[model samples]
Target: MPTRPSLDSIALMRQWLLLLVLAVIAGQVLRLIGMPAADFLGSMLVAIGLGVRGARIRVPALAFKFGQGCIGLLVARSLSAETLASIAHDWPVMLLATAITVVMSLLVALFLVRYGDLPGSAAAWGLSPGAASAMVALAEDHGADSRVVATMQYVRVVCVVLIGAVVSHALGSDVTPPQIPTGTAPLGFTVPANGILTILVLTGSVLIGARFPAGALLVPLLAGSAMQLGGVFIIDLPQWLLCLAYGALGCYVGLRFDRATFDFVVRRLPSMLFSALALIALCALSALFIANLLGKDFLSVYLATSPGGLDSMAIIALDTQADVGLVLAMQTMRLFGVVLIGPYLARQIIRLSR
Candidate 1:
């Protein structure tokens, strides 16, 4: 006779399954609510509240880390030699914009530190443009509080996503979809062996070098791009996987919020908010200048300038029916470029200020 499954075991399995389902559903619901940017932030908020109340809710660290890694891989795929050529052709404008953006971010950080009364480390983390995971990692490396940096970076992401959407809508240019070529085929599930191998190699290299965070973002990106441009593979990471990753990331971020961290954030909230807005304005102005110089439309310039997720911004480009290709290309280019050069820039800023 076969034994029936224990009631307790069955219940546990059910609960686990339910949690996964809810997380995926939550991501879609958040996106539909026009606050998709808050998917992770919202999850974290819930986790923090549970923790504060003494509930034992634990987020799996590996899952969260892997999810971050996937984002890196996807972003890396957006790079190409052709994109590099375009950047080089417009080298002066690109360099000018990049330089100005970095300077503005640093200025905001300094202001927050000196006048906003925030700690130097907190200010530095808060002013880091996009690349939230990387900023948090760098903060930890430099002996800064990871929790504070995470909070500030995520907060800025939320702000940028919201503001970017609103700005696009107001400009009367938000009705177009992404302009990137969809290639010759309809979007479908088609994975290539070479793509997988490339991911493995890139990821492995990053891990060996002790740059896991960089590897996570860059590996998938590089692999995907190679497959995409070589006409051998297509970028087709499952949406469910992405949602799962986002949920895990959200849970991890939220769980970091304890009473002490929350209190600190509250105290520095005003300054953080001001700095975020100032940085956005700086980017927007810089975008306008680049637009004039490059003879491109203002919308393209605006998105390229705005600091947000490459995927999220790409989605926005698609939603607004804009040049999705160019938008993705620029976002991808800037992300890797920034990640590669972030340390150097941080050092330069510290040196120049000193």
Candidate 2:
């Protein structure tokens, strides 16, 4: 015999169900309208509205990690030998562009602290273009304001997606909605063999990556790239699985912004918005210089340097048929760089703000 759930528990379960239904509905609606990152943006909007309405819903922690793992596999499967070769050939430019982007982010954080009245530590983490969930978690650990950090990170994501869409539309880029995989494998082993190997590598990496910060995503990505480049196998994830991954990620992010979180930083939203736009503009200018130096097109450079999540940037690159390899290489390099040095820099900024 099982014990009965309490009233509070039952209420929480209901809230979770309601959240899921609304998120899916919103995501489908957004997809139908041809929006970039439709699942994420739509679910996020619904979650935000519900959160602001005083609903007590929370996304399970494992849900986020699972979503990250799926995205990791998707990106890893994309890495080809050509992509790696391009990064190697343009090593100097990649390093310089990544370094410049990080420095620019720091400068914007400083501006937020001095002029926008945000705390230095929070501003530092908030302005970072690393994975938003990771940044928010790290900010909380470093005694920064997690609420503000989350707000800044998501605000930038929304802006980046919308702006990227508009730019792609204006330039007559791909701008197609993300869909399930629908391509054939190159001349290689049987389909089942390749699929098994891909799943093994993806699962193994996520398990091993559990010990590292944001390792669940990063590890699989690296492992997948290595396997693909080595010609050991290929990855072609199914379409339905990709959709589920997108939904999970979007819903996870959406559920995090509850009413109290928003109210805490409501007054500073305008400043945060301005600071985010300024940072983006500065990064775009830097991309132009790098593009000219390397003879690469401006769109690739801009997307590579744009301050957004690695997953989001990869999606935009795929949609626009931009240099997916270069964008991934640049974004992956920066993600590692920031994860390594961001905490120390946050500490420095906090001291400077004193």
Task: Give each model a TM-score.
Answer: 0.70, 0.87
Error of 1 at 341 (Å): 6.3
Candidate 1 residues 1-354, lDDT tens each? 985332233454554454455555655565564442345544544555544443334576566656655554444445456765676687677656666676788788777666776667666755766567777887788776787778788667757766876776677653531122223322332345434544564456345423455455455555556556666544444445555555676676555655566677788778777888888888899888888998878877777777765645654554565544456556656666666666665565455444
Quick one: best lDDT, which candidate? 2
- Which lDDT tens digits does candidate 2 get at residues 262-308? 77657888888888898889988998999998788888888898888
Q: Look at candidate 2 and tell me the lDDT of residue 293.
A: 84
Q: Evaluated with TM-score, which candidate comes out highest? A: 2
Q: What is the lDDT, from 0 to 100, of the residue 203 in candidate 1?
A: 52
Per-candidate Cα lDDT values, in order, are: 0.61, 0.76
Q: Which stretches of candidate 2 lie over 4 Å from their true place?
A: 1-18, 177-188
- Say what the RMSD of model 1 is: 7.7
lDDT of 2 at 352: 80
What number of backbone clashes does candidate 2 have, counting pairs of residues 3 or more apart or in separate chains?
A: 0
Q: Which runs of model 1 end up more than 4 angstroms from their true locations?
A: 1-61, 68-88, 145-147, 168-210, 309-354
